[model samples]
Target: MAGPWITEHEVSVVEDAMRNGWYEHAYDYCEKFQAEFAVYHDRQYGLMTPNCTTAIHLLLAGLGVGPGDEVILPECTWIASGAGVTYQGATPVFADIDPNHWCIDPESVEKLISPKTKAMIVVDLFGNMPDMDALQAVADKHGIFLIEDSAEALGSVYKGTRAGKFGIGSVFSFHRTKTLTCGEGGMLLLDDKELYERCSMLRDHGRRPGGPAYFNEEVTFKYMPFNVQAALAYAQFQRIDELVGKKQEQLNQYREKLSDIDDLQLNPEPEGGINGAWISAVVFGKSHNMSKHKAIEELEKLDIPARPFFYPLSSLPAYGEMIDEYKTRNSIAYDISERGINLPGAANLTGEQIDKVCDGIHRILT
Candidate 1:
């Protein structure tokens, strides 16, 4: 992956972190970023974590979802989504995705909800929000939490509302690959102070902050993010709008450059939402002579990096037990996973670079 986009501010804060001491008690860069980020998403609380996966784990733990309970999630997400559920010893029931947006289908999510279901993990994959209105309605009817795994969607929006605000809580990844990068960090966004406090305590060894001296309330994971990482996040967060706009420019470039390629199709923009412009992905026509793997290999040979979409949960060995269970139920996810190709859409990429990448694809196919 490419390095994170950083300005002089990140460098200065990191230098100050070293001089002032990262272990200093009064240090507040991390907290500052957390507060700013929370406001950016219109949430009341935000807690930074070491990574998105651990954030999910802590969120699930805080919500009291564990053994014998179930969390419904789309079958075509990064493995970390399922890993989070497994961490709680809860079953991750797979749901099909809408073929157009490649996000969890609300109807499929409703079908998967059982008495044992505790929540629905809706992933805004590729920076697109699923039909949150519909998904939230199902969650309300079932009295289950709607947890948005918005790891790939930081600045996206749906029907005028921010992407992370639709669900009761949302998680964002600040990994280098994301539009906003801190090199490595994650944030949990929510309006519920009780759940926020619960997750905050769970994030840092079950200790509740009592003035400067904290108390150990219960047993929990030690998954706190470093102030150093948050400093980087602060720097990147400042340029979030520019970063998102740059990628949107790249998205437009890719759409224009590859419009004539009948066998290669770009993902659809959300009907009433904005994309975070994470990665410009395409789904190759099934009749193409070049397989997805072959296409990736070809792109590699031309010095253009490309990646296949995540393998559907039904096909992964890690979820073999659930594979058979989800095989018939998640056909759309399976089909989309096999065909989707994630093209590079980094902000620093230039128009020439995008054209070169698209040209490489055209040459490989022709």
Candidate 2:
């Protein structure tokens, strides 16, 4: 039942959009939101999309990734990260994640690259990041594009660079559960002008930009965000620090509560990096005999909400034809996923709730 923390600010802008956003002013909020969001990520351009999945589809299409092409991404991610590649008629090559960071492993990515590989989709999973420098080096060596799926790492930083600033293009989600939400929305951030312009065109059915009204030059997908959603997102964006800070605080509370649990590994804070703390997760040690299912069962009995960490993408039935040796190839992904559990990370989650959850974990493990 956790929800976004909203105030009169979001209500006011949404009302403004509903009342005055029309015709000539229809895109006012969208444009403003897009620009400011991109700048926040230190990118030169931003294109709003209906959702993160649509944004991924748009990025794949804009990059001309199609049949016969392949995209490498960590197996430990949401389905959208892999499903989007299939929409482009491209094959998704699943790689193992770094056990410590829970993001795409650069070494695994390097081993997966091939002549068919056109891009690498590095997901910042659960607000955690891998070694971006090593991944970037691999991409550069192979002459492939680095596309960041930063849907969960909005405020995460690595070596002083924002999560969305590492790749040729990055996509972020503003879903209801995210730190910054507009009910349902996403954005594409990038520094390349040509790719941005091309994606912009693709976002609106490939209408020739400024050539003519209703003139379509090529056939493509339309993933533009509506003004009302932009208004809500923009309102949330205005309080970005507040939203992100609350998540960090929530994570701190979890760390304090679970600090004594030696059998658990909480989200990491690497040197020179700041974890966005989107969803606080804990992975029980293999020797602890506490699987994700068992942990969730115990928490549910105590009326505590919990979620399982993502399953290995290759193990899903939808991807069975693509990779069959998921257990062997992605041992770390499969291993951690079984023991990892996503704790309640709602901005409004109370300390008492966190204490109760941590107590449940301690009781189960001890």
Candidate 3:
């Protein structure tokens, strides 16, 4: 796997956290990072978590989603999105994705809404935003909550608004593979003070802030994020623009290198929308003789790492009961997964390395 672009600043901040970040200073980095991240996204509050999955689960709990409820989500996403719903004893209803955008189709979402539907989680798949206006309209019409799973879209913008600024709340990932990461961490961003406060207390064993010491209001999950991790994340967060720019640069290089290939489609940059370009991905056209499986095999022989796009969640054994209809239910997602693959776009990768990858792909396709 390609590693994140780490610098001396991360090392220094972590060292400081290890030495001086204790007791009263334990959450210094976390507070600073959370506040800045929230401000950047125009959110009123932010809560740090061990990882994105936990953040999604906590967010769902905060929204009061539970047994017998159904949450709508796109079929093409990491299981983390669906698993969180199950944690709340809610059924995750999979929806199809837009052919070009690869995000949950608003129409598909509307079709699946039922009396059991409590909320919809829209994933900013591969750092690309779906039609938020339409999705929000659907949710508003149905009186169900809308949540944004922006794990891969930290820097993405839709209509001048950042990825995390939409819906009732949004969750982000700072995994090793993410654009801005501190090994493993996540953040919940939202504008609702009531929801934020509730999740905050619930995140720490249900101990209400400023309450009696060692007292608990209710039983809940603990998804605490430590100071050292926060320090590392804060350091990276300081260079957010630089990191996002480098990711975009990598994607730009790939786009230029593959400009002559009309049968390939890279991540989209719709008018007024800025793609985060977190993972440089491409989907081979149906007319292309190449398939993702073939591409991966050829790239492997050439020593290039090619990551496959996510399979429809319904096709996984864990959701086997829904697998039979997945192909017809989410045709665009199934088709895209078959042809799509993530390219090597590490921020620290050299131009020579990118050229090699492009050349290998060219030769394989030809």
Candidate 4:
């Protein structure tokens, strides 16, 4: 009745882990989960962290990104993307996104690259993997590190390669809203062995040889997740295929059912990628004559949960002036942010519930 978003299987797994006192097995569970996730995405290594933000921070630090360095990111993504760069004392250069796919535009990325540009974080926003080949070319040309923030793209694939496998380092989130939910967890995947070793040491408090118990050998922070969370994450990973399959089916249903509405526009899968369908998004076309905020309010009144898209980082107070000079103004990223809305995309939503949500939008718009 409350329109639950979490799967019943996930709940059961967590409960069982708690009851059986198996939470202490988190380290072992996380190790296996990381290995499985790496193999699933065809990556060489995977390191689990507390959340995606921390994972991104680890990757940035591991790559030696620091003050005077710049990391390129889309202006339209969650603040965490930009915050990760800032956490490393590296300036985040906001780039506009592709109007069609809502992911960072490769051309825009190239134009923003400078001598200070040290890395680029290409996010697979809304489960859609961007043009990695094109982005990779830009990064390669500039000799900058590329970190794929696959937080919303756990199961997404581009050009026959998985999203997490594209860059030198990548991160994934297991938040409740993601396709894969561990309540609160994240992972860092990388190809370089030395980077992985450094990330592990950093996550564990920089514990070095001569340091005290559980202390770091190098300068690091305690970003590790307890074993309890790791057990739940491992159990969730076991059902990832099932969960992703259900979300994809739900996306197809939404696409078909909402097709008749002329004013509503649905996001399509990328040209050569398979989306995880992490969240189903729809935009009111120019003809809708309704603001995104109004639509969200109307949907909420009808008990159909819908949320407005993320605000561009350039508009935020903390980094507003800094990013304003990055060519993000008057960009497609701003346009998409204003127009987009995320519909309830939980795997547990039944067909009737989805129909109710669609009907609510139709009623408000038409």
Candidate 5:
């Protein structure tokens, strides 16, 4: 059988939910899922949304981050992080990342903060949490909001605190590829009761305190998820610990097999921190100058599926004019973007299959 990533259990649960009319109960499922997720993260509140992007927008909107305000984000992340700021009419000020961990550098972030800066959207890249201690100090000193984009770090920890619990508000993705799969869904976790209430109203089309159609209110975008997705998400959340354990096992196996290879550099986990290990990444050494296209082709030829890391947010046309100014000087993110590749990282791969995948990389690089 092919080495597919999704588990049989996940498939079964999703199918059962679909057959039981769970999708139609999206609103109820969302409420339940939100409560469960918040409890899991030890957060005060949680809101389930259609996707992570919308969750981000909702957070920014709730925070009142709009025109004339600047939001700091790492230049190395996916465009979606920057897009959320743009959607709210906030200027995105790109900052450099810590080359070793591939997360935003707190020192660099401090250099970029200006009078107009309103928030810092710190991303936990590749499941590695940013240096939260440093970032928290900066946000506190400046009186600015900190938003944790924990889309890739659902189970990751920094200084013994979970990812979602660190920021004023945080967003998590439950997409097909995450450690926990919900098909397509997201959640926003926050501690502030007022912010949570605002997010709920905004997500539900600006519904007032009363029931539907009883009171009129300002227009707001509808970004609620269907109950079916929430049902699946809730089910997945119940098994999160098991899923994370399998992912950790897989990561250990990959590290054991490939750590000694001279031409490849594996993703590094923070000291004394637990990473989600959602995706295992490898970067070609400087001597190889191996382009992502060539590396991907070699892996494909060996029946191993690998993908390049996301293009730098600065490289996209939507933010082209700001690229030159925002590109961090001498950051490894540039090199990582060109040479980094994501290995198959779903939770269901068998030990033998993982060996085959590693063996293919060893054969190509050695």
Candidate 6:
């Protein structure tokens, strides 16, 4: 699907970047994407990174979130969200999620905050934005940093505000599977100039911000986004409305076809803002007596590429030692992970393809 969207403009942009030579200067091309992306999200600045993981890592480091600090995270998210906190030598506290939207519950977040808590990484998973307005108020009252991991949600909005605009720093991913693709890339959106400057330095081997190049100030990885990818990303960004619309259409097809099946929970569009995402997901009810694994296996046999939702943080072996501290008893996240499956909602997936996918699900469930 990503392949179909590649226009000649992206190729020409890459070629132009190549002719100019990235070594001598990359800021010209990269900065254009960053600036344009910031404007799109209504953020003050945007810093491009190698990926969202690195974006969150740099965000944590820039904000001085480190050893002995604690960052509360939604229990069900890509491991990167928790790893970002781990990289800073901080504890990753886990909390339950709201069953309806599968986003971190604000009340759960408030309960987890303590003197050691410095921030909360709210994941807008599968294009669903949580109650950021409620969560932001909690953060403001407690003075904890609110970080939005909108890596899976690019154009998703809640209460008329863009996903990444609610926090001190928010991340967006442009991985091949993401709504926008640059093969692999990320963007950090924020309002603070000082924080932005720190992120810039951390992204480029700790150079003293600005640049004549080759002035290393401290130890940092090469997290900078390449101009070539940036060019490709900007090209994809140009067609965002078309891409989002196509996904929403595909989602509609899934719901219209599958919604009649009793005991099958399809993705819900809780109206507050434009929840026009097309993330085709289904959670099997207790009566179905089928595990998500079995559904995925059956889908694969039919060549229907389905993905499982993330295992709750406590459910995974990686977070074994901290289970007692972070685990919430009878977590809804764990229940959702056990039952949910994500079908292919590729930006370029054809109506025929979506139909086949839905037909396969209907056959399996019945």
Winner by TM-score: 3
RMSD of each: 1.8, 1.2, 1.0, 2.7, 2.7, 2.1
lDDT of 1 by residue, 1-366 (tens): 134566787799777765674555333777888899989989999888888888888889889989999999998889887688898899988899998888999999998889999999999988877888899999999999999998988778888888777677888888877888877788888899899988888887778866246667788899887877787788788888887887677777888988988866675677777887677788888777666688899889999988888788768788775666776788888777877788987666777888899899888878
Across 1-366, the per-residue lDDT of candidate 3 in tens digits comes to: 356989999999999999999999989999999999999999999999999999999999999999999999999999998788999999999999998989999999999999999999999988989999999999999999999999999789999999999899999999998999998999999898899989999899999877899999899998989999999999999999999998899889999999998889999986898999898899999888677889999999999989888888988888975767778878888899889999986668999999999999888888
lDDT of 4 by residue, 1-366 (tens): 212245576577667556664545546667777898898888889888899999999889888899999999988888887687898888988888987778899998898889999999989887887888899989988899888998988678887788788889888988867777677889998888888887878888786423579544676777887566777777778888777787788888889888888866676777767988888888778788776788888888988888888777787787855545643453677667778898888767889998898789778876
- Model 6's alpha-carbon lDDT is 0.83
| Collision count for each candidate, in order | 0, 0, 0, 8, 3, 0
- Which residue window of length 10 is worst by lDDT in model 5? 1-10
Quote model 1's TM-score.
0.95
Spell out the clash pairs found in candidate 1. none
Q: What TM-score, computed on C-alpha atoms, does each candidate reach?
A: 0.95, 0.98, 0.98, 0.91, 0.91, 0.94
Model 1 worst lDDT window (10 residues): 18-27
Measured by lDDT, the strongest candidate is 3
Q: What's the residue-level lDDT of 245 in candidate 6?
A: 74
Please report the TM-score between candidate 6 and the true structure. Answer: 0.94
Note the Cα lDDT for every prediction shown: 0.83, 0.89, 0.92, 0.80, 0.81, 0.83
Measured on C-alpha atoms, candidate 1 has an lDDT of 0.83
Give me the displacement of residue 153 in model 4, in angstroms: 0.8
Which 10 consecutive positions of candidate 6 have the poorest summed lDDT? Answer: 321-330
lDDT of 3 at 213: 98
Off by over 4 Å in 4: 1-26, 208-215, 321-330
Evaluated at residue 171, the lDDT of candidate 3 is 94
